[model samples]
Target: MTQAVTVRRDGDTFQARLFWWHAARLLDPGSPIIRVGFENGPKSFDDIWVEYDPKRSAQDQYGAPLRREHVQCKWHVSPDTYGYSHLIDPEFINANTRSLLQRARDAQLAYAPDGIGVRFKLLTNWRLDRADPLRQMIGTRSGAIRLERLYGSATDNSKAGAVRKAWRDHLGLDEEELRVLARTLAFGEATDTLDGLRDNLDVLFAYVGLRRIPRNESAFPYDDVVFQWMAQDRLEFDRKSFPAICDRDGLLGQGEGRRHVYGVKSFEHPIDRLEERCHQVLDLIPAFDERYIRSEADWGDALYPALRAFLLSAARDQSKLRLALDAHATLAFAAGSVLNIKSGRHVELEQRTTGERIWAADDFPPDVNWASLEAEVVELDPQRPDLAIAVSLTHDIAPDVRRYLSATVPTVGRLLMLTPSTGPGAQSVACGRHAFELAEAATRMVREARGSSPVAAVHLFVAAPNGFTFFLGQRQPVLGPVRLYEFDFEGGRDRSYTPSLTLPISTRTGDPV
Candidate 1:
């Protein structure tokens, strides 16, 4: 008799959870995913398969008109790392068998014979070795290989060249053949824990009309259903059949309309399911370090222009938008400016305070006495041309602002500290309406201060909720020549304020004021 196999339940469960994450998208008619499969694809990298509709702007991988992503999930209890040289090791390829590279090539020929539209992803909890040349060859945003790095000059003798040559020789392929394979391969770090994946699923469930797993309940309804399907050898889901399965499993709910979620990521921490949940994603992270802008011109040349273009295009179809911002205070404000009150669009901001809440200006009735700003003006050098305004709604940021100004910008002659009348704390702004009202009052106060002095420019430093910051940005036009600043929350550099975007972009030339 054959020995019974001991299954790694942790790995199995992780794969199953990942399957549901992609499979649930079928419930949304607007989603680009047309089909999802469990344990049913090419043998090499086939934990799951997701086919996307080519018509939609789907999948970060660009070349293919019709895209199908093949994913292999490798989950381990302990963290580990791999480097470029490990690709030919026994870990990736057994001695007498086809290597991972070979299998990828075979899968490409079988699915996309023309060498286009196919992506193979190795999704693991493992990290890439920081010291390896492979780290530099990978695109941070897309998870795809950086082709330019892989295809260096003919006389190249760098470590990257060695990696490329090794991979090519191991695969028994020519330069052109290696390039084709490189384009199709992606290595991605799985950032979610099992609990985190569940939380993410709950959010997706709410959006796609599935019954959410109760917080207090111990039962894993989605997991149980997936296991039962696996036992029954039911491995595939398409747009038509997935709904029937949902109905049979008593998982159906009143579905929401196609949500147009946009993610503006300008920081290190990533938003969960940003690419999957968002209709459009503005990846502005490349222009920033933890504390400062990489290049000052990035605001005008890259960040603002990209944001403006995306919002303008999205506004053409969507009357209402949902924004997920993992960004700086300055960009958050700039986003609000693009979709200002005059734009005739309703925007709901994903506000992650004590918990997640969708905040919109029209969600509640405005109260005249909800919140008020108490302003204090301090005199600096009278000869200086700039005035600094520190708006501390969440906490008192005046000390930090003062320190930053003293050490850096000597051009500021005055400092204006604005705090909520109720004193600075998290609940300073009562609701969305209160935030709008407070923003308006804050803008009015700035105009008054500017009028009293011959200040050439107003420097703004804000410590508040994203919704409030956005609302403040919407009112930017009336406040002349305003420069926004961002705090180094991550403490990557000196924990201080750094200048970011300047408002009132020139209309004709499309440049920052």
Candidate 2:
């Protein structure tokens, strides 16, 4: 039997696991949710609402791409009266209930052709009391008569009726809208709590053959693991791509043939081999002196310090740290995508490399005139104009970059915009093949533009997956010098751009030198 540890609950751990649970559903290849995120969305929900397209596959999911469903998360160590009651009580609606309602109203309006319907869902760990009428009311699509019957009137004098009347008055909803609310509001339950998720994460690592970090030694590094996973996978992890090592059913001995096979034979050989593989991957994860893995040591703070120390050690020569840091950021962003928003940098180390190979397109698009597509160019007028190329993959090219280009450059050279077919105001990159084709097109543009004007340098403003960035660098047309700029989220969307690193172009080979 596997060891079971009673883990303590922390809010951060709960949120992390909740995020992962949401990931399992929304990030699944067949799921409709194309994007999701933490704590930075609509007013009411602490968790993000997602815009899901049922037709799309798993590769499309990104963080906070669109909004469709407002998810509110409520965490409790155990089932409680206040928490359960507050979910439905009108006065107890989350702080920004009015805003959420307004957004919902906008979605329902017929005048807005592109309007998307929004729904509210409360995710909780507590096993709901099915017997409770309010719980049942939220669980079902219809307004329950229990409250109405108990109170006898919409304006009943009793406390229950008063509460019901207050809720209706607060929402200012008519009968039809109230019915819509009953249908729109829903609840979802997870199998794990904070400690449960931590334990399972260890199991996940162990399934890949990694040794467990004892609970007493450190809280499970959920965020670090998630960052590493996203970075390594190029933000493409989903349920089918990355399944839980052991699910609730499997842990309960309910898995198909597991019980029968256990009685008939010893499967230690295969299990041992699998565990060995897990160990191999575990070896790749950077570990510190074991002192920093504490649960209370600033939630998810272990990775940065460990990464900094690793970079410093590897870049023993202080003079080489800048270049090393750039190289490290490249690998971390491209492979693991561990970007730090505040500093406008990617947070990851140089030592670790992903087992999975980064994606690349196999062939270029056969047909299509690359030159005909008007290239949006910026000329600084220094004899040979420096070419600035902005390729938008997951995010729309920031409007600020567009304004800057328009304002700084007097005349238009050429502009080509690639956007996602599915998302609004954004261009999407399909599998690596499409990304490669896009890169080839960019290269063609460079060559064509250089033929007409003496191009001295290239500056890239890319809002794309790190894999696409790596592939873009690979497919760059031969140029004298290339500088890439990282988007500045702090400066506002699509506005501020900062210099990241220069791609050294080889004059001899015409490739990234």
Query: Which candidate has the top score in lDDT?
Result: 1
Model 2: per-residue lDDT, tens digit, 1-513? 111221223444566665554453432232444555556454455454444554331110111122355566656555644333454444544453444444434334422223224445555555556444354333121111222333345554754455455446756766556544443444555445456565554433432323355768665555445544444443443334334422321321221111100000001110011111111111111221111112323212443333334433433333211111112222333222112122232222111011112233443443342222225444444443566666655556736566766665433344435443344222254444555565556667667766666655666666655445544554433544665554444222343554444544122332110
RMSD score of candidate 1 (Å): 6.7
lDDT tens per residue, model 1, 398-513: 99999999999989998889999999998888777788788888888888777766778889999999989999888877777789887777454567776777887764554321
Lowest summed lDDT over 10 consecutive residues: which window, candidate 2?
258-267
Give per-model TM-scores: 0.72, 0.34
Looking at candidate 1, what is the lDDT of residue 44? Answer: 64
Model 2 error, position 429 (Å): 1.6
Candidate with maximal TM-score: 1
- For candidate 1, the per-residue lDDT at 47 reads 85
* lDDT for position 271 in model 2: 8
After superposition, which runs of candidate 1 have C-alpha atoms over 4 Å from their true positions? 1-8, 57-66, 92-106, 112-114, 153-156, 260-320, 324-331, 341-346, 351-383, 387-454, 459-472, 475-480, 484-500, 506-513
